[model samples]
Target: MKKLYIDYDLFLRPAEKDQPHCSYVLRPGNDGPACLREEISFLFACRRCEDYPCVNSCPNGALKREAGLIKRSGFLCISCKTCSIACPFGIILPELLPYLAGRCDRCIGRLKSGEVPLCVSSCKNGAFRYVEEDDLKGCPDIYPMGDSIIVKVFNWLGSYGIKK
Candidate 1:
């Protein structure tokens, strides 16, 4: 079974400095840009819903279900942004990226070796941890930028695209 965890230690903004000093399931990140981004993203993660509109919307079959998780095939993708459009929460974030860019495989290689994922292991601050998926119920999947932001932004920016 897959589990999700929250890193509470990274929440404090540098100015706040004083760590709340407790294990919290949900808290806003402090003023740091990286922490703030992670907090915002963590505030909105994958829903893993029964009806995956993102998968259904993929015309190239780039996205699929395997072992209770959504897997993406970058090679098969055409980067059409249909799956991004189909996702009600906009969590896919594939608009300006190449096809299959938004997929997260849950670090299968590390899990298979009975080790923690790189993201978790490399987290020197010890803020990373796993939690029950039920805790994140009802998270909105769509992004606020709308369906075509990926392509639209890339076109306007001209080669300096956004990074994940």
Candidate 2:
């Protein structure tokens, strides 16, 4: 199946052509679609804080550190946004959290018929694309977020000054 990939580098840049937008009108007070589009928080580098605020912030122990990465428990996550606020670097985007993030659907009916999603069509900079799994090979900046969603991480200012 085709998957959704977003150029987060382009996504963060100011749009010179037009204001970045998605035609998919999410319901009022419902930002599920917005979260679905930006669900790339896992790719964010986990700051080895002396005390992991995000992990401790979870009331249900839904987050933990494993192999230096912050692993989230989908079954335990309640989409409480507490962790998002607790993140010191603001890396944890609440919108992309599982159980809390709304489904993007990939414009399901149309996608199955060989058409792109409304959000993909709306991005003038070509930041979003629905591509085959094989199309992602050799792209170092692109990482798969889930079974059908990928994200591009490039030119990120956050990692600019840290020395390895």
Model 2 CA deviation exceeding 4 Å by range: 14-33, 43-50, 58-85, 93-101, 154-164
Q: Per-residue lDDT tens digits of candidate 2, residues 42-145?
A: 44444556688999999999988875557777678898889999998777876557574344555667677777776676667767777887878997766677
Candidate 1 Cα deviation (angstroms), residue 93? 0.7
Q: What is the lDDT of candidate 1?
A: 0.44
lDDT of 1 by residue, 1-164 (tens): 33434333353222343332222223332112233232233233445557988788788887787644566675787878787778776556543335223333444565677765444544445444343445445543312222111100112112234222
* lDDT, residue 116, model 1: 56
Candidate 1 lDDT at 79 equals 73
What TM-score fits each model?
Answer: 0.36, 0.58
Q: Please list the C-alpha lDDT of all candidates, in the order they appear.
A: 0.44, 0.65
Give the count of colliding residue pairs in each prediction.
Answer: 16, 0
Model 2: lDDT to the true structure: 0.65
After superposition on all C-alphas, the RMSD of every candidate to the true structure, in Å, is 15.3, 5.6
lDDT of 1 at 15: 33
Model 1 weakest lDDT span, ten residues long: 148-157
Clashes of 2: 0
